[model samples]
Target chain A: MRALCWHGKNDIRYEQVPDPVIEHPRDAIVRVTSCAICGSDLHLYDGFMPGMKSGDIMGHEFMGEIVDVGPGINGKVKVGDRVVVPFTIICGECEQCRRGNFSVCERTNRNKHIADKVFGHSTAGLYGYTHLTGGYPGGQAEYVRVPYADVGPVKVPNGLSDEQVLFLGDIFPTGWQAVVQCDIEPTDTVAIWGAGPVGQFCVRSAILLGAQQVICIDRLPERLAMAEAGGAIPINFEKESVVERLNDLTNGKGPQKCIDAVGLEAHATATIDSMYDRAKQAMMLETDRPHVLREMIYVCRPAGTISVPGVYGGLLDKVPFGMVMNKGLTIRTGQTHVNRWTEDLLGLIEEGQIDPSFVITHRVPLERGPEMYQTFRDKHDGCIKVVLQP
Target chain B: MQNAYGNHSGSSRAHGVARGLGWFSIALGVAEVAAPRALTRALGMDGQESLVRAYGLREIATGSAILRSENPAPWVWGRVAGDALDLATLGAGYRNQNPQQQRNLGLALAAVAGVTAADVWCARALSNGAGQQARLPMRDYRDRSGFPRPPAEMRGAARHLSIPRDMRAPEALQPYRAG
Candidate 1:
């Protein structure tokens, strides 16, 4: 089978590997038809995250037909059933899962000790993500073995195209979750950092959820355009003082909700803090650059919510806990609970409330994954999202 | 489940490290439990040997979990967490030690920190399920129609970075946050 494999920092390849076979009763195998390179995947590609080995399969956002199933699947899914496997690998029956905290599912991450040590607990297994999450082979391959099939894979309607639903696997819900978690009120003003795929989704979702104003921050012209297309007020962070602009826009109250759609690899444009973050990251003194985190807190209205939909790994450096506490701000974040919103989001999709395909700027064969990985990571050639057909 | 966990090259190396750390943890735990006074004296703990003994028991428990579980992620993770507490306690009492004793304690802490990194690495490697149970029975599959896939006629008809954006939302969307 052909799959995208990680070789090292910035080294991804399309290689032929052995086909996947079911190893558990509740597992299913999907022949990937459509998959996308997530902004988070760049963390691995850039070697910002750890625990990746050469030849590890890569990808998480995907949807396709079930090529095989395990006996334990119990007919919840079967051969020939087209499905979109959630990035999370879960046992739907766990207490955490029952409570809607699917990202912390106990049954999926067999190697709980890793996350336990880092985070004081384990997170749910994720497909083709990092070892911190479960190291399930991602959906970028010709075939991927999906564990907990009864729980994670959502059935798709025949009328919709792969592009419309693929983000449901990760970014769509991530954007949706990022917004709703902010506890939005109709009269509130929301400010989002980054206009990438997830940020765009947040723009759309925030508007859909009733925010009166949505402001998106980014330097990329195309992404800013998309954010505008999604009905957001665009702010070029490089050209404008975000704090001043946000303050001026909101009558000095700042934004009621601030979202960090850009995560660890956020670029610094000659700013002193970003320069220091870059220096520290290069020296291995810090694992993550929390510039956005600090920026969010700095500009958020007192008692406003700060939401992170972006993917950050390892420790945050010098977080402004004092400021957060003094201002009574609430911090809300987590990996997107991919399955939790699948049904409702699907219903929204079915009702024509949204179309998610506008985020895709490029579609290539699975063979082009390695280069496209670079394309997406470098943000070159006007690329915002890349979907691959395997 | 095997398909999910298997075939990664790092798995065995990680499991090996996990196992070694497990045995090492047991040995350290036993020492703490059996020779708490001597250990304390060596580290200049000021006769607080009982605390060392408690920590030793914790090491033993962590080691036991690493040894018993096929994927020792949770257990080894505990040791990494413990290392912080251990370091914090050591640092808190640094003013009480003689120069030589302080050096010895520093070396011990450094060693623990290094081991913590390795333990974290190994635990992470195990997250790929090298020695873990992830098996399920298999059956062949054919095909089905759904939103995740374009129609049969449209399959492989995609343009470079282009899609049918005009369609409604996809048939399936999965979340990764709520496990």
Candidate 2:
């Protein structure tokens, strides 16, 4: 099989590799039909995520048909069933799984050292993320082995197309989780910190959940425009102070719910050291999120909720504590539990409550996975979301 | 009533009742202090720890359901305990904490539970200790080996059950199906 391999920072290639087989009883082989590049993939493209060697296949967001299923699998998902594979490969019966917390599944990536040896250490058992996710080959290829298929592979609803469900694997659900965690109520006001794909999803979700006003903060004209088109009030931090704009818009009370969808790679201006400092702070929250958390405290109303659904790393820097203590706020954050909500999200899509395709600004072939990674990473050519067909 | 030893029979009965009341009071006190910590520990360290803490405080206002004698502590504890069990087993990096921190959290939870149990025990002993000569409610020791779910419907299960919204609307899903 041919797979797109990550060689080094900004180095990805389409190469021939061994075909994947059912390695475990819970595994399934999926023939890749469509896959997309995530903002996180840009980490490798920009040489930020370490440990990438030559020939590491990269990609996690994908949808495909089940070409084969391992023995002992019987969840009514069978051969020929179209499925969307979740990025986190979790065993359904583990302690983490019993509580529906699959992101940190014990059995999925137990041998992190060995897997990282093969893929990368930044990910646990991601499909194409190199060493980060057990270095298991990714779906940016002709075929890929999906571990814990019964738990990881969500059966695509009958009527939905692959493009609609593609983001379900990561960004869509992540964005949704961000909004959901904000605990937004009817007539509540929300401020999101980015307008990327995940940020856009957060904007739409905040509106869907009945926030009376949604303010999207970003510097990209295209993304800001997208946010406005989606019915969220747009704020360009480059032109105006986000805090001031939010204050002016909300009459100085601040938003009731705040979400930081920007994660570690936040955009900043030349003069403001705080934005760069905040990005570093955002990274620390990857393990113990304190920086963005503190920012949420500053920008949110007292007693309001803050939700963080951005992807983060293990180590981070100084976190703000005094603000969090004073605000008497509720902070909720975690990796998105995609399996729990895929069915309902599918229902909403079918009902036309959300159309996620608006985020897709570019479509390329699987062969261009490497190039898409660069374009999406640089945000060049107004690349918002890139869908790759195999 | 007359005592065989020529002591006042009413005094003997009163003394016996008082001793039983003391024992009941002590038992209640122990339970009140122990209950919250046990429940929190069982739930593991996650969002549930905070929830259990809030519930522990609320138990004072709403009164305790632990005194019902059918062993409701495990159910309450299970709601929180079950939340983190899987993460514990998965070798989650968060669980790879400094051993001291892990132990400290455990001790804190135990202390909280112990305090909760003691409070309940004391209240029960003061109110109903003399009237009923019932056995002190025993702690229902759960087998850590087996997973625990509450016997009754857990409050706030709906909130905990919420999944992240990554899946797209059915109409938006068309692209993936495109060959």
Candidate 3:
């Protein structure tokens, strides 16, 4: 099988690797049909996410067909089924899964180092990255093994196109989880802190779930315009004060719900101190630092709910505890339980209530994945989402 | 399938009750450890039927294990009674673990039994041919062609997918020609 492997920083290659097969009774082997480069992948490409080594397979967002299923994987799914695999592979009967906390399942990629060596776990038991996830190969290949198929892969509805259902694997559910965490009421106002794909999904989901008004903050004109098209009022932070603009729009009261879709690499204008730079410094000290999270606390309404769906390293620095304490806000943050909502989100897509394919702005062959990584990292040419077909 | 146990009805119910009690104890234990005040208040009710309900659930769970043994079915009634007693005794152990969890366990156990009962009834209905299986309304993708191959015009060149105009519809729908 040919796969795009990450050898080191800025070094990705499309090379041949052994074909993946059903290694476990609960596993299913999927023929990669369509896969995309995620914003998180850029971290691995830049050598920022620790514990990554040579020859790691490099993708997590994908939809595919089940070519073969292990003996134990039956009833819930079968051969010849088209499915979207969740980023987190969990044994549905495990202790963590029983409690609905599938991300930290004891069985899947529990030992970061060992798992990485085998499957490439840069962050968890993720497919196609270094050891943070267990280094199981990624979907950016001709074929890949899907662990815990019943709990991890969702069957794509019969009528929807693959492009339309692709993001349901990660980004769509992630954005939806961000909104769900916010606990937004029908009449409440929302302010999202990014205009990227996840942020745009948050905007669209907020409106669909009945937020009276949604404000999106970002520096990119293209992304801001996209947010506007999604029915959110865009705030160009480079041209205006986000806090001030949000206040003005909300009649001196801040939005009731705020989400930080922009994670560690969040940008800042020349006026305000850059949280990204500060986070990098904190990372050096091995401290608990939350730069954008602090800003979120400052901009949110008193007693408002804040959801942090943006991915972050285990360690952080310079957290603003006083402001969060004084604000009386409720904070919910984590990886999305994608398995819980894939079917429901697919239903919404079928009804035409949401069309996330609107965010996809590039489609390339599997071999061009490395160049696409560079383009996305540089944020060049208004790239929002990139899909690579095998 | 005939079971080694004569009858499983009484034991299954007992097991359900025990499992419910175990969950209850765990919840109460959690609550006791985390929020002692809440735990005391919740357990303050007259005769503590909530606590009894929790115990019943634990017995039901224990009954499942018993029913799985030889002569599973007929032994259910005896196992249920035994499980209830065992749960009451185990509740104290929960206190030693985490008071907060104890309280949470109590609350959780009560809820679990109710849900478990509902699950058992549903399972029975489906098993008895009393319910019809509904075909899932799945999306059709059989005729779908593979993703577009990389255009020959842009071979080796990084070409981005064009953002739909309706998504933003540039001030005028002018085509965004690549430089």
Candidate 4:
């Protein structure tokens, strides 16, 4: 099977690997039809998250047809069943999965010992992510061995194109969960940082969930414009002050809910704290940049909520915990429990309320995944999302 | 708005040069700090060791600023100014220098001249925005909202959706409430 493999920092290759087989009784072999380069994948591409081995397959957002299933799967999933595999690999029967906290599912991470040492407790296993999660070969290939196949792959009904259902495996539900965790009220103004794909979804999700006003912040003109189209007031942080503009929009009060979709790789170049982070990062003194996190803590309304759908790894320097404490902020953050919201989001897609395909700015063959990684990382050619046809 | 680095290569290359220069600055500064006596002895400026160390501190500060700052133009310009001061100090030592000392001073002056040229060039490139500034796009995307209807009508369209109890904010923080 041809797959995208991780070599080192900033190096992804399209190479041939052995085909996958049913590894366990509950496992399934999926022949990938479509995949995407996600923002979090950039974290791995940039070599931020550790534990990735050489030649490890690289992808998480993908959907395809099942070619084979283990005997334990029984008839729940059969061959030729089209499905979108959620990024998180879940055992379905774990306590966390039972509680709908699938991102923290107790039983899926094969690397639980390593994760326990690093994270105090292991979270759910994820595809094509680092070994800290399950080092499961991801869906970026022609075929992938899904460890907990029956639990994670949501069956896609016929008539829905791969584009419409693809993101249900990740970004669509991720954005949805980011907003749902905000618990938005009708009169609340929601401020989201980062206008990337997840951020775009955050805008649409916030609106659909009934926030009174949605503000999307980014330095990119095209992304901000897209956010505007999605019923969000676009704030180009490079042009005007985010703090002042957000305050002006909210009548001198800060936004009631803030979402940091930018995560570890925030690019607030003009700010002193970002400079500090870059300096520390270059010196290997800091692991992640928390510029958006700092700004959110500073600007969120007192007693408001801060929901982070962004991926952050390792230590952050100089976070303003004082502001968070004094303001009485509620910070909710995690990897998305994708399965918990896939059904609702699938209904939304089926109802014609929103189209996840709108986020895909570029589509290409799986072979071009390496170049697409650079194009997407650099945000060249107005590339918001790149969907790969494997 | 037009970004100075239209194609992005120039900006990326400029940042690469700026980073190289930053590391160079720190390396040169460290050399001076650790062995000011060696530099002074070579130049025959026996009493100027302390001054050499002071300039080394300046170099370290400037280098740190360049490496740490997103914009390195001003810091590069600072390097140019520091180069000028170094030349002036070396030239002032020329009056009392012996033949061997003059040769070493001349060599020192040429080395400073070379670095000074790089500093000036890097500074000008950065100031003109031909260097490491972000390349903002001219592509318009105001129409790419993912909604089926106009956003105004679609606002709160998913209100029928339920918010899980654990996910909801405390009652006091809810803006719209039930009687």
The CAPRI class of candidate 2 is incorrect
Alpha-carbon deviation at A349 in model 1, angstroms: 0.9
Q: Looking at candidate 1, what is the lDDT of residue A154?
A: 94
Deviation of model 1 at B110, angstroms: 41
Could you tell which candidate, 1 or 2, scores higher by TM-score? Answer: 1
lDDT tens readout by residue for model 1, A145-172? 9998987999998899998888889898
**Where does model 3 exceed 4 Å of error?**
A110-124, A268-272, A275-283, A286-290, B1-179
Task: List per-prediction Cα lDDT, in the order shown.
Answer: 0.79, 0.63, 0.67, 0.89
Provide a comma-separated list of chain B TM-scores, one per candidate: 0.67, 0.25, 0.24, 0.70
lDDT comparison, 1 vs 4, better candidate: 4
Clashes of 2: 59
Model 3 has how many clashing residue pairs? 93
lDDT of 4 by residue, A202-226 (tens): 9999999888999999987889888
- Residue B54 lDDT, candidate 4, scale 0-100: 92
Sort every candidate by lDDT, greatest first. 4, 1, 3, 2
Per-residue error for A212 in candidate 3, Å, reads 1.2
Model 1 chain A lDDT-worst window of ten = A267-276
Candidate 2 residue-wise lDDT, A1-390, digit = tens: 888888776688888889998888888899989888888777667566655667877888888999999986785578999998888777778777777666666567745776455435322356766555566677788888888787778887768778777788888778877777666555578898888888888876766666678888877777887777666788877677777788888888888789888765554221234433533443543333334444667778766677777666545555555666677666667777777667767766766556577788778778877667766775655667889888
The candidate that achieves the highest TM-score relative to the unseen native structure: 4
Which digits, one per residue and each the tens of the lDDT, describe model 3 over residues A279-340?
A: 24444754223556767788888777788888776565556667778877777787777776
Better of 3 and 4 by TM-score: 4
Candidate number of the best lDDT: 4
